[model samples]
Every structure is written in structure tokens, then in C-alpha cells.
Target: MSVKPQSASAPFAGPFALGTLAAADGPAFPALVDSEEQVLDLRTALDDPALTMRDLLERWPAVLPRLRALVADPGAVRRPLADFRVLAPVEPRQVFQSGANYRQHVIDLHVAHRAPDDERPEEERRAEAAEIMDRRAAEDLPYVFIGLPSAITGPYDDVTLPAWAKKPDWELELAVVIGRPAYQVSAEEALEYVAGYTIANDLTDRATVFRRDMPQIGTDWLRSKNAPGFTPLGPWIVPTESVTDTGDLRLTLKLNGEVMQDESTKDMIFDVARMVSYASQSTQLLPGDLVLTGSPAGNGMHWGRLLRDGDVMDASITGLGAQRTRCLAEES
Candidate 1:
């Protein structure tokens, strides 16, 4: 006996999804989707004239049931994805990025900055870093930073390396999109506030990360990480209901055709719920707010190969579609 091949329309391809998409000549619009190959045009499905990702998220409680029904109905206005362009799923009102969240990434950073004359065995150095990370996770709060909305660009857009930037780097992260208001939420209840997840390339200017002018003030993230087009975000938003495990996802990034970062979210020092709950303690996270879970190891600083003009980066997380960005030197 022979088995039959599965078709694109089959249920085995995984559950359906929703995304923000547009035609080649139009502005972004909300969508109900099946896969990259099949998109069900949703502008008419939604009666609102100004529908957007933020709009969907704000009305998530009411829209979710309709979305599920649309997922089952196969006769909606359909179009091949090749005819449409994907956009950043949401225009966030606030962006919060978790810093130093991966255990192995932290260890690599510590080992990279050893003193020239410091002579410690590799095993000893590794052990020390691990111990510090363990203590930090147990006792310390997650380090969260604000990101400007102006820094966000479409997933396939060109990223210009500012003329003043010398050591630009790539940090691909898994970012959670908030669907409901969250203030003073407990860690155990935090996941309920999430709308979905998407991919973000949190581009950084490594050389300017620290503030030499005011050592006391320490890091200057705005100058280093929020330059125009620094955050290349989204090909699609994978709804929270579709994702069963936030702690286990394979994330990978490539420069041109060569792989640079390949790691799992299980390596995170602080998991997604902890980061969201910790962030909400101080800030009111509204619908469309973005909580960026930090990147894994294999950044430019760790690899000794920083980003430059003419390089292309392809970053992806499981289920959340991939993003491709081309780098260019800023024009004078």
C-alpha cells in the first residue's frame, strides 16, 4: 500500500493564523491566514475602514472568536501570498526589551572581556559565570529597557548603518505583543495578557553601547539601539492560543547564507512570564505594547564579526515567520 502526500489546504500543516498584510500598492491591513502560500483577504471581512494590528489587539477579546470561525471557513476571499506584501504586525505604543536574559549568552560575554593578563582555566571561568548567572536569576530583577517606536521598520526593509556607527550588531529576539492591559500582574497570571508573538531584530551599535561621557549614567541605548530602522519586526503574529510552550523554540539567524546564531529559548535566564510580570510591575502594559524577550548568544561581539554595509541578515523563530534585511551605509 502507498500513502498519499498532504496538500497545502490540509489540516496537517498546522492551525491557521492571522497577520497584517498589504497589496503592492496599498497600505497595511489585517488578515486571516493559513500559511505563507495562502492568505484570506480580510479587509472586507472586517467592516472597519481603519483596521490595523493595534485595532485587532485592542479588540482581541471580541475578535478572537471571529478569527477562529474564519480559520474554519474555507470560502473567504482568498489570495496567494506571493501577490501580497507582509508588514509589521503591530505598531506598539510602548516597547520594552529584556536585557541579559540568556544564561549561555551572559557567560560568553563575561569570558570575552577577561583581562589581557588574567590567566584562568577555561573550566574555572565557565563555572564562575554560571554561578553568577544562577545567583542573579534567583535574587535580581530582570533588566528592562525602553525602545522608541520610530525605530521599527518592516521585516524586509533595508537597515542603514548610521554613518557614525562603527560596530553594528544583530540580536534576533522573540517579542510578545500585549493584548490586554496589564498592571501589577503576578507572574503566574502574566501569560494571559499576551496577544501573540513575533520576531524582532534588535540591531545595536556595539561601539556606542556604553556612555563614556557620563560613566555614572552607564548605557546609552537610544543612540546605540534606536537608530532609524534598527528594529526589523514581523512577518506574522503567531497567536498565543497556537503556541503551547513559550520556553522552547528554535531561533536562528544567518548573515547572507552563513548561520550565525542558533539557540533555543530554554536557555533563557528568565522566562517569558517572569519578564512580562516584572515589566508590568512598574509600567502599565496596554494592548499593542511589545515585550521583547532578550536574544540568545552568537551576537557579533561573541563571534568577533560585527555587521557592516552590504551584509544581509535572515532571522527566524519557530512558527513566527522569518525576516530578511539588507544593510546599507547611511548617505551623507
Candidate 2:
């Protein structure tokens, strides 16, 4: 299955991006993908068969120059990208997910999801939500949560909607990949630790988001968002230098050919640097760790539409490439 090449307005800023790919006869290996959708086998180009994406990221400062040289004059024979199966670009040791970080998204949820007894005017509810969001952005830190790395799946893989997940939904987001150790970093210096950017669809089981049995404890992120294949990540990692503005990229997610979520990174209450800096305050973020900025407005819940079997999600972020994931019902 050959993959399609990026159009004239390619999302990647650099001539090439790093990815993980596997041929039918071989194990997964690090690769370099060009705009034409041709892949250079990095394992062979670097002459280190054991090298992984994590290894490159850990030594990014050193590896970057070498990668650039290879792209300039790739003497090695390149293969069609479709010849190999694309996998998640990196295997993160830790995943930090920001929640309610997008301004309009929060407002949309606030207006759409109301108490059954409440009968406020639509405009009134919207105005009140907007005011609350403004205050939260000014006074509160980003709301972040931990996600299991085990939930990650390939960009084009099939996601099994668990039988118990009655209200499955899609949340396409911009993911920040860490290049260096970051602890107690300030927002001003946070971008220096970034390795690159990727796309992640943080699928959720809305029905299980809130723990009814224990309202005091609140959200059950593990059960609601960490199911296997819940996080469909990456066709490749676009270097941070490739992105001109981390705070101004477009994020769009389409379900079964219908546009559902369409918004820009500018709508985010907490930008990439702020989100990473906030996460670093408590945890020592290592190389390859992923910090997912919150998804923008237009989730399934907002449209009163939920995921069903055989639904396909095409999610993309500006210049970071796209992911195509198919939804399947868990077998009985």
C-alpha cells in the first residue's frame, strides 16, 4: 500500500522528516522521509542497524547535522514509503496530556454540555463560559494529566472501540516531542528542549470520563483515554525549526469524510511552551517524552455525533503531516 506524497504546501518545513517504518520481511527501523514520500533507511545510511528514533532524539544535537548531510546527498538507495508500514514516530517513555487548554474548545464544551435542569439562554451561557476561560487563562496553570505510553498506535492503524465505551470521540492535537532533560524550566526557555512536532489523535471514551461512583475523585483518565490504540500518533516528526510559529498552526480532524473539528493553535489558552514548562515543573521530562497540547474545538460531543464501527478519522496539523485511523468495534 503506497502512501501519498504531500502537496505543494507540504506541512514539513525541512526537506526530510524522521519516522519509523517496517518492510514485510524486516523489523521496524528508523527512516528519513522526504516530500516525495520516499524513505531512506536510516539504519543502513548510518550503518547502525540497532538505532531507534529514541536513540536519535537522545543524541539530537549530534545526530541532526548528520541527518542533514544525508538528506543533502542520499547516496543510499531510497525505497517507496508505501513499501513499509509506518509506525508511531517515537516510543515515548512518558506522555503528558494537557486538558481544557484550548480556549474555544472549552467554551464549546461548556455551552454544549449543560445540566439537564439548567435553562439559561444560549448567549448567556456562552458569555459566562468565555469569562471563566479568560480568568482561568490569567490565573490558573494548565490542567495536565498523565497518559500511558502503551496506548499509542501507528498513525494508520485500526483502533478497537471497547465494548463498554459507548461514547467514543476523537481529539486531534499537536504533540511536542522533547529533545533534552527539562526540569523546572521557564516558558521562555522551554522551546529549547523541544525536538520536533507530531500529530496525535487523543481518542476518548466520554462515557467513562467522569467517575460517577466517586464524583469527588473526578476524571478517570486512565480508563477514559488510555485504552490500547487510543492515541494514534505520527506519520513522522517535523523538526521544531520547520514550524515558523508553534502557536499559529491549523488543526483539523475529519470523520468519515465529514469535517468535524477545524481550528487553529492560536485558540489554545496555553501554548506549547507554557504547557511544556508547566509539565516540567513537577516531572523531569526526558528525551522523546511527548507533551500533547489540548485539542481544538469541534469534537464529536459538540456535534452530537459519536464514533461508531467502521468510522475513519483523518487528522492533521499544519506542516506536521496527517494520520488516518479506522475505528472498529471490539469483538465479543
Candidate 3:
């Protein structure tokens, strides 16, 4: 991923002084690049001896000062953001994805939304549904699951099919990128430590997802959810400051420009604030960590379908931007 030379005049425009390119002018990044055309390898850039996450945050008051100077010259050092291959914004030691955290997601669960009548008493059904609703409320415990970090891929990367899988699905979700170490933080204090948010597609295999062919109650969720390139994020991280309200934002998914799934962040079962707080209750969330906030309704499998080869899926949020990925057939 070679860097492109910065231009004299700004290439894109928006807030945060993009220098030659601004936020609005670029593609909406779920992992880091807005689109393949404007991809950037931020990981390689950070790996440079001159920069580190610590330096970007606190060690140096001005992490981009040197880079800023470099960009200003345009002719010196490497190229601009338009030149590199986009990469996942975070390299987390572990990834966690919330399940059925949105109201519509619950409705989409269909039969799984509840147990058989004989298994659950009337009281139990009501209580369970109440509990589920509480969690989905903007003000309750946010359920989360550990996701396979290796499943992550860049914005424009391809989503591959898994062997023995009858169905493959795409879930458009709003992902939280952790900025710093946080432990047992309160909901009110959670957003302060957030680095930003990006669109994430929580791709899954249908068979393993429901443990349909498995013998045991617990299926290999990691294997089902963490296929290669299962997670597609970026096109750059939208700074937390730029978003006015994570809850009120509209989220939509399109297959080759046709809207497939569309909803608002306000429908989330657990809002970002509660999610951050609940996640930090036991473990420390480190910088460069990612939290996939679950998907809304309208997944492929819900309609007895799956993503086929050459299918292009693009997910977008109101202010955060968009991430597009092409679905490809698995090589035997």
C-alpha cells in the first residue's frame, strides 16, 4: 500500500482538518478507509517507529504534529490517506460482539425468540421477555459475547464462504472502538474514553449459528462467527466528537445499492453508554480494542437466503460513513 502524494489544495472537506482531504469528502470508513479508492493502511503507519498508540493518545501532546508537518509539505516522506490499503482500525487481543441487542433483532429471531410452550411457563415467558426488553432499553445491562479477532478484515475486503455451511449472513452493526484502558466505569463516563465508532458487518454461518447439526447445546460460535474476513469495518474511524448522538443515528444496509436493512440507532437494545459500562465491569478495555454492538433486523438468513458469490454489501450510518465489501465464493 504505497501512499499517494498530498495535493496543494484540499482533496476533501469537513471538520477536524483533514488537510488535503476532509471527512465529508472521503468515503465513510467502517474499519479505516471510506472506500477502496481512498484506502489507508493506518496499522503500518502506526507501526512506524515514530508513532505508537500511546504517543497518539498521551505520551505526546500532539501525536499528529510530526505527521501534520509532513503532510503540509506533501513532497516529503510518504503519501496521503488516498494511497494505502485500508485495514481494520483496531488490532484487539480479543473481540466481543453483542447478540440480539436491538429490538428488531429480537423480532427477527422468530422461533428462537422464545422457548416451546411446554418448556416455559406463562410467567416465565413474560419475565424473560421483560428481561430481554430491559437489556434492549437504553438504560440496562448490555449482553456481550467474545468474538474471534482473526475474523476481522479491512473495509473493502471480501467476505468468504465457510465449508459445510448451508447459509451465510450479513449483520450491519455499529461498532465501538475503545480509546484507552477502562475498568468498571459508569455509563456516564464511558463515552469519554471512546476513541470512536465505525460500521461493522457481523457475518455469520447459519448452520453453526443455530447449532442445527451439532449434538450439543453449545455450538462453535467462534467458528461460526469468526470466519476469515467475517468482520468488515472502516473506510476510518469517525472521531467520537463528530457524532452528536449515537442512539439517534440512522443505520442502513444495501446490497448492490438496494436497501436491505434499515433502522435507527435509537432502536438498540443497549445504547453505547450502557454497553461500555457493562463491558468494563469485569475486564479492562484497551486502546485499539473493538466492540461490535450487534445488528438490526433484515439479515439474509432470516429470509431463508444467504449471500452468494459476487454479492456486494454496503452498510452506512447517519454520520459515521459507510463500509462496503464484496462477497466471494470459497476456494476448494
Candidate 4:
């Protein structure tokens, strides 16, 4: 599950920094952007023990220049990549999750739970969804739910399956890392608040999504999604400048090396800018807030599969590095 270090002879040009892993004493340091390297022995790039990636985001304008300079300098400290353990890029203060934003994913769910109707054809139902999707895009409102930061875990950490969860599933999403304050901003100006992007697997407990006892309350995402290790995030963050297009990146998840979810951000009913702008209406997105762009189709439920103990999920977004998560069952 490891890769070779970047060749010393040919190093890529500067302007990117987002990898972080635990050091011998404490807080993870930024990994080098020097070519395609997996060696962590490069030494601590940022020596601030009290600082986390959240701090970096707050001071992005300053840290970014330091990152670029570090990458270009040849004699910077480095250690063996295998020595350090990976950590989530940032421990965000607030997390906003967009729901029902993927067109095809919603259609798939509708088809699965469709009622028996003699008059209307299946095609008619799909057409209706498409129309609704168009209206949603046109409308300024976007649906978002609040999530606890405690649910966050390292990109490669194992997800602990609670005993209460009957059917656990994976929802791989593109997570937008907020770098600046945003309040009631327009969609046209939302991207300016982003620091970078990372991969997120929003694990949900399907069976517990709704409380049958209180059907009137609707979906319960907290129980269904905020388990100890529900949100697996980041090998590192890819700076916004490095990402040329957020609307067209491909997101894919492989379970045990078998591709399950494969779709592009192009299918999103509300793109990243819209989601951020929508969230900022009521919430003041601070320096390390996160907006999880809803996941696309091909979830395990749609594929007649659900996660179990010993299962592995390898998720990746174009440009952003990959994440590996192993699913484990909880014991009494």
C-alpha cells in the first residue's frame, strides 16, 4: 500500500502544500510538494507545535508563500516517509454537509422505493426528477446539514461500525476546505473563500437514517452519519490554485480494489460555489470550516451491496491524493 519516492534528479515546480502526518513529539507537519514523493523523512517543515492545518488556513496568505519556498529549497529537512503516520489535513471547527445534490444518485433511490402505479411509466418518474433537479439548480436555496467535527478521522483510519448499525454504507464526496470568512456571499464569489479540496467518505447507517417511531421528524443524519469514524478525510489538501476546475473533477471509490462509485462533479445539482454561498446565508464559515459536496451515484445500496467488517474503501478525487479506510466491527 506504498509508493516510491520522487526522483531527486527531477522535482516538480513550487506552489502546492497540504500533506500532514504525526511527528515524534506532536502535531503533523506539512509534507513536501517536491515531485511525486512518499518519503516523510524530509523533516518538519512547520515547527509550530500548537498549530494545526486550521491555523494554516487562517493564515493561508502567509503560510502559502512559506510552503512554496520550502518546496523549492533543496536542503530542507526530510525523514523516511514510512516513519510518520498520516492525519486528517485539518480538524475543522464546523462541518456542513450538502444532501440530495447529486442528480443520478437521487433518481436511483427513487426508482428503488417507487410505489406501484399502473398509469405512470418509469420513464415518467425519471423525467419528473430531472425537472425538479433543473428547478433546484435555478433556485438559490441549497440543502445542507450540520455535522460534528468529532466524527472526523484520518484518511487511512479504520471506520468503527457501531452495533446499532444494521447497514453501513459509503458516500464518497468532494470536500471544500474553507480558508476565509464567508457570510451571505453570492455564488459567483464563493470560490474566493476556499483554501483547497480534499476527499471525504461520508459513511452513513442506512437502517438508522430515519426513526420509524417518529416518522414525522424525517431523516436523522447525526445517528446515521456522525459515528466516531464516520467521516474519513484527507491525505492532504490540494491548493485551490492547483485545481483548475472544480466542476469537472472525477470522484471514484474502490471497495477492496473494485470500483463502486465513479462519477464527475459535472453531475452535481449544486456545484461547490453554490453550496458555499448557500451555507454562508446563515452560518459564518470561518477559517477551517468544511462543505461536503454531495456524493454522486453508485453507492453500495444502489449496487445491492453494503459495507461489512474487513472491507476496504480506497477513495480519490482528481488531483487530490487518495484515501484508504478499513471497516471494522465493534465488539461488546
Give me the candidate number with maximum TM-score.
Answer: 2
Question: Clashes in candidate 2: how many?
Answer: 1
Candidate order (TM-score): 2, 1, 4, 3
After superposition, the stretches of candidate 4 with alpha carbons farther than 4 Å from their true spots are 1-15, 24-27, 30-33, 38-49
**Candidate 2 — which residues are off by over 4 angstroms?**
1-11, 114-120
Worst 10 residues of 1 by lDDT: 1-10
TM-score head-to-head 1 vs 2, winner: 2
Instruction: Please report, in order, the local distance difference test score of every candidate based on alpha carbons.
Output: 0.84, 0.89, 0.65, 0.80
Clashes of each: 0, 1, 18, 11
lDDT of 2 at 257: 84
What is the C-alpha lDDT profile of model 2 across 142-176, one tens digit per residue?
Answer: 99999999999988888999999999999999999
Query: How far is 71's C-alpha from truth in model 2 (Å)?
Result: 0.6
What is the RMSD of candidate 3? Answer: 6.8
> Taking the tens digit of each residue's C-alpha lDDT, what string does model 1 give over 1-332?
01111222212123666667778788888877775467866667777778887888999888888887777776776787667666677889999998899999999888877889979987889899999999998999899999999999877778889999999999999999999999999999999999888889999998899988887889999999999899998867788988788899888999977999999999999999999999999989999999999999999888889988789888888877678888988888
Superposed model 3: Cα runs more than 4 Å off: 1-81, 110-140, 212-216
Measured against the true structure, the TM-scores of the candidates, in listed sequence, are 0.93, 0.94, 0.75, 0.90
The local distance difference test score of model 3 is: 0.65
lDDT of candidate 3 over 173-263, digit per residue (tens): 8888777788999989999878667778988887776565666776567768888788886545566766778888777888877788888
